[model samples]
Target: MIPKESRNELALDTFIKAHPHLLEEMKELSAEDRQQQILWAFEDEAESRGLEAWELALELIAR
Candidate 1:
């Protein structure tokens, strides 16, 4: 299963999609690199929201 933090980051897909440059950069990454990037993004967002990494993941899955 993916970590909670990872799920939160994946949720950014909408925002990422809205930014063509970011989307292009994301598309150019290898699958593994992309996954890591997403995970880190989640961590950042979770920190900003004052939510634990796992909490974000649970929230994402619950949706």
Candidate 2:
């Protein structure tokens, strides 16, 4: 089962549709590799966008 924190209040299908190539790449990775990639992506995204903006985005999407 996916963790709620990982869900980030966004639909899985929506994320997949928005990032099909990244999703496909993730499927090709080992479990550990994919997890690290995801974590790094989250880190990079948050750093680029700012943590406050990231929180706001999550709130907006949840609504």
Q: Who wins the lDDT comparison?
A: 1
* Tens-place lDDT digits, model 1, residues 1-63: 767556656655543454456546688789888768766776786789899877755665666
RMSD of each: 4.8, 4.7
Worst 10 residues of 1 by lDDT: 14-23
Q: List the residue pairs that clash in candidate 2.
A: none
- Per-model TM-score on C-alpha atoms: 0.58, 0.50
What is the C-alpha lDDT profile of model 2 across 1-63, one tens digit per residue? Answer: 546656553533343355577667799889788767765665565567666535634643575
State the C-alpha lDDT per candidate: 0.66, 0.57
Name the runs in model 1 displaced over 4 angstroms: 1-24
RMSD of 2: 4.7
How does candidate 1 score on lDDT? 0.66
Position 63, candidate 2: lDDT: 51
